[model samples]
Each structure stands twice: as structure tokens, then as C-alpha cells.
Target: MTNGGWFNHYDDPDEFWDDEPLPIERTPLNPSPSPSPPQNPSSPPQKVVPTPKPVEPQPWTTGPVSKSAGAERLQSGVGSSFVAVQVDAGLLPVHVQLSPQWHRHVDGSEAGAELMRAYQKAIGIYLGETIKSGKYFSGEFRHPSAPPDRRTVLMLLLETASWADYRETQTRIYARNGFEVHGQAQIQNEPVTSMRANWFQVKSIRIWPDWARRADPIQIVDEVLCCANRVRELRPTFKIRGDYSRYSDEDLEYQHLQHRENLIEELGV
Candidate 1:
């Protein structure tokens, strides 16, 4: 120690300072991620597929039957060129076309008779086809192919007459209780025409000429069918008066059969 001064405590300062600095162990703020293993070069490259979107389901619908697909046409073997008639599946006439040569071969006086003959022939063909296709009922009501016994013949005649009477009664009932309904046609939100129906038939129709010219034929048919369906729904509401008022269709049919049986018993046939 010297007066007012500090002294170094090393035996040799040069020997302590002469040694190389030791390597420092330090940590970085952000470390690098570990590398992935290398893939095999011979292997095929993996495909990157996109995720599929969900599909929405579609609604089901039915379309109306086409006329050409539903109707059948036949040529009646009458006149020189013959008459062609088109009918639907239910044997309701759709169209009747007369050839130009019809008048040439058929006289004006006999034209009506010839036309009826043609209609009969076409109807016969239709019935034959229906029977062949097994669509016609092969029930007890079917006509016998061979000659029938006296009792069978009598029964057939009675049945025919009974059915005729039943139809006549139905017609009379309808005539008595017939009520009219009105239907209207619209074009572009405007009333274009109206139709009046008496029970099952269209009694009268009044169409605006201007609207008729612009109205769609398909729309007209649709409106008419709608009105007809409305009328059909009312058919069951027409009740007969007196004893048959409460009778259902089946009940009326049974009553007719019972009456026929009673007649047969009375005649001993």
C-alpha cells in the first residue's frame, strides 16, 4: 500500500490477461423450426383435391298427358275415301275428319245413313280392341259368344230394359234439379269472357272478341276444365225426392237388381 493510492493484488497481471477469451453460451430471441425429412424422388407427387360443395335436392312434378299419345284414330270402311275418327282412352270422340271424296261417292240423301254406318263400324272396332286387350269387363253382364237359352235371352232383355229405365230416371232427376253455375276467363288480370253451365253441359258462353283474339288456347282449355271439375263435384249433391232420396249409387243398383229378381220370380223364368 502507498500513501493515498490502491495497488493491484495479482502476482503477474500479464499472465492473467494473456489467456484467450472462453466461448460464450448464448440463446437467440427466435429459434428456426426443424426441417422436414426429404421425400423419395421416385414416388409420385400427391394430388391436392378441393373440398366438394353440398348438393340441393330437386322437387318432383307430373306433367299432363299429350293428346296424340292418349288418342286413337281409326278409318271407317264407308264411302270411297272413308271417314276417320279419333277417340280417347274412354272411347269419347275427340275428332272426326271426313274425306273430300265422301260427297263424291255418297249421295246427299244417304249421307246421314252412311255417316251412321261409319260410326257404328268405328265403335265396333274400338269395342273389339278393348275386349282383345282385356280392358273390358268379362263379368256376368258380358254378352254370350254363342246362342243363349230362352231364360238367358229373357234375362238379357230384362237387364237391358232395366238399365235403360235407370238411365231415363237419372236424366229426369237431373232435368228437375239442374242448377246453373257461372265461370269467368281472365286475360292480363282483366275479365275477358264468362261461361254458364247447366249441370254437366255448358249452356252458353260469351267471349269478348278483342280478348279472344289475344287469349291463349291452352289457358282457355284449362279454365274450362276447372269449371267442369267444379260441376262434377256437385253431381253427388243432386238427391232424388221421395223414397230414393237417401239412396247411394250402390243402393240404387241393388234396388234395380232386386226389382229384376222379383219380376223373374213372378214370371217363373
Candidate 2:
């Protein structure tokens, strides 16, 4: 409200700072002629602390991990490596590293689940017509690593499939459309104790990454489908190598027969 601020009476903040005296035309060499007050006996002398200069931060260095003196040694390419998921795409398994971003794309949403089911049914149809003879039935599976907390299935294409001999078990799993059924035929008066049906085994299963370490089969199937579709889109038939022509069933059986004959000749059995 006033023409000048209330602070006009005093010098600016700079004059009062750093023990600096008020502005004058000239600084006198002599001391002021003021009477000295009586010194208090209780006052103690204060020490002046020297200000320290600030230190600059050092630049970061990147090299091989430094090992402690007693650190256990690890072999080369061991302990420091990570495995990315690779689904078979023709010759090589297509690599797909699992990450937070990738996790969103294949979260087994409702749509994805339905699509996977359709693919599964189609694969089933292919296997149903391909495998016929009971002698070709095979039952062997590698134990999965990090078993999924929930049941998950992986639909695979069999390069060479054949039905194996029927075996009886209490497990009533072979009651599906793909499975051939008999109408309660009496075997030997053993009242329906065991169910006899054909078991099919594929000579080759589509390659997958180290599945023992896989935790989610659903994620695996999703990733595999992504890889397969991508490869198929790029190349109509993207196959690096095939074993069907190289090792036919006849050739394998002939080798087995020859090996058995050689063993019989040596052992006289």
C-alpha cells in the first residue's frame, strides 16, 4: 500500500551477510573508538571448522563378475546362463524368451483356450486315422519338470504313429471317441475286470525346449503355437530336417531283427 516497502530503511541482504560491514566511501585502517564491554569469564573459545570440497562420483565399470577368494568355481557357460523357451519349428526349435510383456500375449485367456481346444481336436483326428495296428502302441513320456499346478495338455503332431498292443489296466482313460470300443464281449468269464483296447505311440514327437524345467504347459503350448504359426506363415513348409525317410519303420525293424539274430548266434539261444 505504501510507495516504498518496509525494508527500504535497511541495506539489502548482501550487506548483512558474511560478516561484511555496511557500504562506505572508504574503509578505515584504524579500529572504531568504542568503549570495550567487560568480558564474561564463562564464555569459551570456539574452533573454526574448515569446509571440505565435494568429491565427484566415479564412473561405473563393467567386466566379468568378480569372484570372492573362497568362491566355488563354476564351469564355463554354467550357472550364469538362462534358458529361453524354444518350440519346434521345422528343423530348429524357435526361441521365445518368456518375459512380462510376452506373458500378457499368451495368458490363456478365454479366446486362446477355445482356439487351443480346436487345434487339439484337429490333432486328435489326425492321430485317429494315422495309428491303426495294435502292435505299434507305445506308452512312454518324459517326466515334466516343474509340474504345472493345474492340469495342462500339449497337443503334438506325430511324425510316425502306430497303435501298440492293448494292455488292461484299472485306469478307465481309453473311453474316448478316438479309441475303438468292444461291446462288453466276454473274454474268459472274468467279469469285465479289465478293459482291452489299442494304445498308440508316435515314433516321433515334435521337439520342444527342455520341458522338465517348464512350469506351465499352457504357456508352452501357447508359445509353441506362436512359433509354429510364425514359421509356417514365413515358409509354407519350414522343416530343417526329417527322419521319416532317413529311418523308415521297415529299416528299423530289419536292423532290430539282425541285431537279435547276431545275439542269438553269439549266445546260442
Measured on C-alpha atoms, candidate 1 has an lDDT of 0.44
Candidate 2 per-residue C-alpha lDDT over 1-269 given as tens digits, one digit per residue, 9 for 90 to 100: 53332333267733323344456687688969899787788998658999998863321111122221112121111210122433221222244344433333433232223323333333333332222211113322221121221111110012212111111110122222222222121335422111121222111112222331333544544444443443333332212133444655556566545644554466555
| Runs in model 1 lying further than 4 Å from the true structure | 1-81, 88-92, 138-269
lDDT scores of the candidates, listed in order: 0.44, 0.31
Query: Model 1, residue 4: what's the lDDT?
Result: 38
Tens-place lDDT per residue, model 1, 1-269, is 52432233465433333344556788887888789889999999899999998853221111122211222222223422445544333332344555655545645444334434544455556654554444444432332222344333333333434545545544534343533343466657765444444432334434455553444544433444444445444443322234443546566566657866765566565
List, in order, the clash count of every candidate structure. 0, 8
Lowest summed lDDT across 10 adjacent residues in model 1 is found at 59-68
User: TM-score of the candidate numbered 2?
Assistant: 0.16
Q: What is the C-alpha RMSD of each candidate to the true structure, in Å?
A: 28.9, 26.2
